[model samples]
Target: MISLTMEKRYEIGLDSYDRLFPNQDTMPKGGFGNLIALPLQKKARSNGNSEFVDGNFNSYEDQWFYLSNLKKVTIEKVEEILSIVEEREKEELNQ
Candidate 1:
């Protein structure tokens, strides 16, 4: 799934990753610029920290079922969203 939040994170990182880590040439080396620990870690899940929740913030009873049903977002859709975001940002800067 190509979530808006996830894509926005990628967009922001593309713009700011190097400035945030001047000493490290991570992006140039094909790195994502940072390491994010895998979600749903056993310990974190047990503590109610890493579980996916619903819009109402209720934990789903069948996380695996929910995950299995998610449809994949296409690359075209992602590029479209990125272009919209870029245009919006430009408008904001001009305001």
Candidate 2:
């Protein structure tokens, strides 16, 4: 699954495996573009030390670590989406 991310939105292409799933009769008809958007906002905090309260901490090492974890989650999500497409293809092939 080819994936792309822009801002807070993500999209994955599923055109190559179109033959795997049943046609529109069995499934909703749509293009290969599966998109997901996550609008992020800094949560308000009572502690003045909160990252949101102290904007300078945005680039802290801990923040980078958190972002790294988020990157892993994003990768996993893309893989999960591709697995669905692969499963449909396999089912079609078996039929």
Candidate 3:
């Protein structure tokens, strides 16, 4: 998984991946020219758009839509939220 700040997630979620992590095989010969470069994971397309999900949609992992507008990337609670969502899903399915 990519270890990116929450702000990055929002930007990417809004089809801004190309804006941040430009489509390049490797770092520019010299240096990125004021581009918002990021180390993207192999799963992420070199140049692709993100799936637009609604903020209230909780089924999607990473919860990008739900937390996209956050002022700060509160990564500290990612696992906690995931765990809680998982537990809720399991309980609902078992009922």
Which residue pairs show backbone clashes in model 1? none
Candidate 2 stretches greater than 4 Å from native: 1-73
Give the least accurate 10-residue stretch of model 3, judged by summed lDDT. 37-46
> Which runs in model 3 stand beyond 4 Å of their true positions?
1-20, 24-70
Cα lDDT tens digits for candidate 2, 1-95? 12222223444335534553233223236542222111122332223333321256543435435545543458888999999999999999999
In order, what lDDT does every prediction score?
0.66, 0.44, 0.50
- By descending TM-score, how would the candidates be arranged? 1, 3, 2
Tell how far residue 36 is off in model 3, in angstroms.
10
Q: By lDDT, is 1 or 3 better?
A: 1
How displaced is residue 30 in candidate 3, in Å? 32
Greater-TM-score candidate between 2 and 3: 3
Residues 1-95, candidate 1, lDDT per residue (tens digit)? 22344476665444443443343433446553433332445666788877778999998888778877889999999999999999999999999
Q: Report the C-alpha lDDT of model 3 over 1-95, residue by residue, as the tens digit.
A: 12354355654444534443444435557674324322223223234333324568424445455456557646768878989999999999999
**Total backbone collisions, model 2:** 0
Error of 1 at 55 (Å): 1.0
Top candidate by lDDT = 1
RMSD of 3: 15.5
* Model 2, residue pairs in steric clash: none
